[model samples]
Target: MCSGIEHGSCRVSDDGRLVWAHVVLGPEEDWQECRVVLDARDGRELARLPLDGAASGSHHMSHPDGLHMGLCVGMGQDGILLHWARRDGEELTGRDLDESSDRILMDVHPGHPGFLTVEHHGADLTLHALDGTVLAEGVPEPSDEEDPPRWDHSCGFVDADTVIASTVESDEDPDRPLHWMLDARTLRVRDAVVYPTGRVRGHVRPLGDGTWLTYDDGSGTLDRWTVATASA
Candidate 1:
């Protein structure tokens, strides 16, 4: 196990040479500081970049070409900040995602170019493109007669046409009971899957053969399901 004490958020760079880790180095009450550390091949620190402000929900997505990385920065009470990083002559240069709406950014799709999904006021969900354009926006519908649609926290894409999102009925219980798979091209809920485990943080990724790999954080295991069966 790596003993550097990483705070949960981590990403493996496309080059596979470094592991970008997001760390919080302060008390819980205070603003959580954010920084990225480049771990060398020998398990040693190579470089560190401290962010401008403290970030709450920190997520990372690498560029398709793997030469650049996108850092999704979320403020506890304020909103979200998108940071772009690229190699600058042996150094990494970064900047803000844009100068427009700074709502609480929830998650980003790994396969889409400049595609961002955000949550605001804890209930509203919106999708954004690379140029900060709103691609799609809506409120999740109630899952059942007893449970009404409430809030969703995270999302990931399985391919160019599909996205899996987490949904809950209330803030008191954030564990998503239903995993929704939406059509990216249509921005409509195509199907819903009842997780065998209770509320969990899960991500959907394609496996190249009409299959998907669902990583359920709550269960600490991976579940492979065919798109056809998962949708049915």
Candidate 2:
């Protein structure tokens, strides 16, 4: 049992071997902070690290390897927090990829040690190696042709070769928000897609087969989407 579970960040690794969470250290309003790595089966606390100067930790994604996990302060920050599951007490690193700031962790590649990040909205989408080298970045055309579109905050890998993302239109038809399939390496838009629903700020998660999931706030339900369906 953990306290402050609602305000914390939590995730279980793909292999089901570990669990990581960020919780407040003290009272509610004065909530001091730290992240905890736990033994998944027994709910034992394996380690905890303090997050100084952060309002609260929110976004968390696990690496496919099960030992590497990424954490973000969930604000418009300049870095991502990486933690090693095997390391002892308070073990973590605050990393900023060479020149990229205000970028947040979106997802980690399943076959590689690298991760993905995008500027606050969908402005600058970049992939960086574990050593901070840029693997690839996006070059989408300007949205000025129509009303400017706002880059979305959620995106992730649908497979080793592709990524899925959303775009919020400011002047374009608001009825159809733009979703995209991008090449994992070159970050090129392979396809543009839309949903039967309206604009929402949530995640596009790959379900390990050919399907993806999105949250439809209007219905308060998880909506399923697929690339094959869109193409047909």
Candidate 3:
């Protein structure tokens, strides 16, 4: 259904069943806005939700429960909007979440009640409940040195209770990026993650099975990582 028309990014739900994207509803001269949800398994058109006066966003996400969706609108502006919608009796009802900062929803928790978000400029991170309630917020502590690491937008939950995040200053070398482990609920620094030799780079992408994934630029291969347990 997204043929020969203006369409935004398409996001798939955590279950891999639902896919959605915002599209222009009419001709260029008098186009409106709407979101089209599709069934991923069979490529069938599922629902079309009208978006009156709603601006499209760069980042979109389908809720884990498969009943709702979220959009991060107006990025790079002085203020950003977090819009969410859910099907209500054949109609999609939505609202912009009331947030005090301009942040972007980077990742949603797997098998949990909260989602992860980072500041628009990647300065801080916050965890929020499914209903937009703030659960925890913080950034890693700066080290006692001339140049401390800055948190980037590459962050997500490593599991149900732990989050994996990275820090690489804009002017710094990407090969020397640092990563951290944080308590998902409290946003507290749990530890600084250190990888084995030659596998020390790449942003973190949680696989939701206690292991995470990373890509190596030099080798051009994806790597899976998990905490090594000590012998008894």
Best by lDDT: 3
**CA-lDDT, candidates in order:** 0.59, 0.64, 0.70
What's the candidate order when arranged by decreasing lDDT?
A: 3, 2, 1
RMSD after CA superposition, every candidate = 6.4, 4.8, 4.3
Candidate 2 regions off by >4 Å? 1-6, 26-32, 75-100, 145-148, 170-177, 194-203, 214-223
lDDT value for model 1: 0.59
Q: Please give the lDDT score at residue 65 for candidate 3.
A: 72
| Preferred candidate (lDDT higher): 2 or 3 | 3
Quote each prediction's TM-score. Answer: 0.62, 0.72, 0.78
Per-prediction backbone clash count? 1, 1, 0
Q: Identify the runs in model 1 with alpha carbons over 4 angstroms from their true place.
A: 1-10, 19-39, 42-50, 98-111, 120-122, 142-148, 170-177, 191-222
- lDDT at position 75, candidate 3: 33
lDDT of 1 by residue, 11-115 (tens): 878778877766765555553454455665766655556566645456777766566667776665556667766655556566675535665544444555545
For model 2, residues 1-232, the per-residue Cα lDDT tens digits are 2343335678887788778877777776676677777889999887776765453346677767665667666432434343333344456544434333667777876665567777765576788776557788884545545544555776777777778777655324565545778888888888666544445435567664557787756667886777755551
Q: What is the lDDT of candidate 3?
A: 0.70
Cα lDDT tens digits for candidate 3, 116-188: 8887767678888777888889776675557666777688877788888888652255444367788878988
Candidate 1 global Cα RMSD: 6.4
Structural RMSD, model 2? 4.8
